[model samples]
Target: MESERYIRQTILKDFGLKSQKKLTKARVLVIGVGGLGIPVLQYLNAMGVGTIGLIDNDVVSLNNLHRQVLFSEKDINKTKISVAIKKLKKQNSTSKLIGYKLYLSKKNALSIIEKYDLIVDASDNFPTRYLVNDACVILGKPFVYGALHSFEGYVSVFNHKDGPTYRCLFPNPPKSEEIPNCNEQGVLGVIPGIIGNIQALEVVKVIAGIGSPLSGELLIFNGLEQEYHKFKINSLSKNKKIEELKDTYELECSFDNSSISSDAFKELLNSSTEIQLVDVRTTEEYNDYHLKQATHLPLKSIYLNHNSLDFEKTIYFICQSGVRSLEALRFLKKEQPEATLISINGGLNEFRNYDAKH
Candidate 1:
């Protein structure tokens, strides 16, 4: 009875009983249960991929219902693992599903990842994507990568058979503000279905050993334009070492620099101070709440107009929090290594609070 469920997929000459058998025995891990992850989980379970491991630490939210199909309005504030697991179980009782209700971090990444034969990196952030890629590289397991932004999404297979890795494709994380979060830039629900299904297809092809698995190529889809493109990724030739996982948010990941305290930042903000202030926050953010003395150069346009700043002078940087400011500092340092660029310790939020105290 269990074998009959997968007969339709097994009916293909190339993907016969043998491939079905392989899928039944394969252990796979999917790292997210969000928009991209929902479709991957659905189709993979439908395909009867045995021993599916789901690792996500988020609870269902009102915002998630817009694109994440696994949870409903009633499930809001409930754990995604609980909601998704129950739904998947009802959909395919034959496939084993284990859900971890915790997020992936450097501490648990390697241990949790090593247990799986393959990984699907449907993770939302650049840090986790790098974390998963490094873990898979170390574990010698191929993982499918999926990312969504606005009406665009892309899928690729990384760390397959010592092939090009995520770093091979994107050697550096984009400047934090340059890549907007889903909350900032909206994505159509159908986009993830397209990319996640392709990710699922790659998983099937790799496990079944049936067709080309997109090992060294990237697939990009634009929902607005209804266009698709595939490009070759040749990171294998570069042979950049992925011997071990470095700090995902460190200089190795392409953004690392220094920070200054709020007290010092306020002194610099004082009229007597002679430091140039650079605000990496958006024009809207600047309009809302900003230091009058600070110059507006959002992180997205920093690379283009960074040279306009007088590198010889001491420049202080600030953002909503210190994170983006540090990222901007790193970018500035890379282009102008000699520039004395330091981010405000607590960003504008802290700097503003300092004013209330005074």
Candidate 2:
């Protein structure tokens, strides 16, 4: 009976009935239901993970359907957790799937994370990623982390028996604009598919104590070049102490203050003001469908093309998500301190939602 359930995986010499049983007994928490979270959650459920918790505050969107396979066009505007729970339950009725439809914040991070055997950081932003890591560290729970850029992806396991935390690798977050998010730069749908599936595999390894987990090692994949590289994460600081998980985690991820909510800027957009609406997303994103009258100046070009902006107008930056637009706002502020600028709270996601409702 067991062999038939995990027939393919159990065939491997290292992963037999014993490992499969371990998988069934494990409880996993997947944070985020986006590109990475979808595959991770799918495989875990199929593998018969006894219980799984999914946390996401986002709703399904047309853009997410390309990569987030668990969702369909009909799922548009539905909460990610609700959709995931419904689909995953159909995939494996035996597994208990719980959905948390809220963003993971420091306030409830520890309590929510403490119950799970493992935490998967499929979160896109730095703030939440670091928050997950610090919470896992504090709770002594192992977590698998995966991040993707345009064509590249990184995967690592943190807070394992002796593994390094996310802080050890990225001791400080880079300047907001220095690193572009997947929204601004654009990601091949398959990139996260490849990386997130790998993360799910790693989670199985950790649970079964079978194959060597990615502990103390970082795996990097370049989809464009089809090259794979593994770097030894220095374990020299393994004994280092973890004191607190706070907004400081934001510093490590290089998040800037300029990132604001679209709700906060909605009033600004409605005012009888000649505001310069800047689309920091790529041309492809802008062409697909963007705010009316928004200028298509990609974030990467903003630094060198600051003169293109009309300082006289109230400048408002926007991106697929708020991340890149915030970076654009930062760049503008540095060049023209006197210029007034603001970032749409949730960027295009919020704008599109508001448009749909109205």
lDDT measured at residue 220 in model 1 versus the true structure, 0 to 100: 88
TM-score of each candidate structure, all chains considered together: 0.73, 0.70
**lDDT per residue as tens, model 2, 42-115:** 99999988999999999999999889999999999999988889898999888989889898876679989988
Candidate 2 segments whose C-alpha is farther than 4 A from its true place? 1-3, 236-240, 247-358
The ten-residue window of minimal lDDT in model 2 covers 247-256
Please list the C-alpha lDDT of all candidates, in the order they appear.
0.82, 0.83
Question: In model 1, how many backbone clashes occur?
Answer: 0
Residue range 175-214, candidate 1, lDDT tens digits: 5556787878887777888888889999999999978888
Model 2, CA-based lDDT: 0.83
Worst 10 residues of 1 by lDDT: 247-256
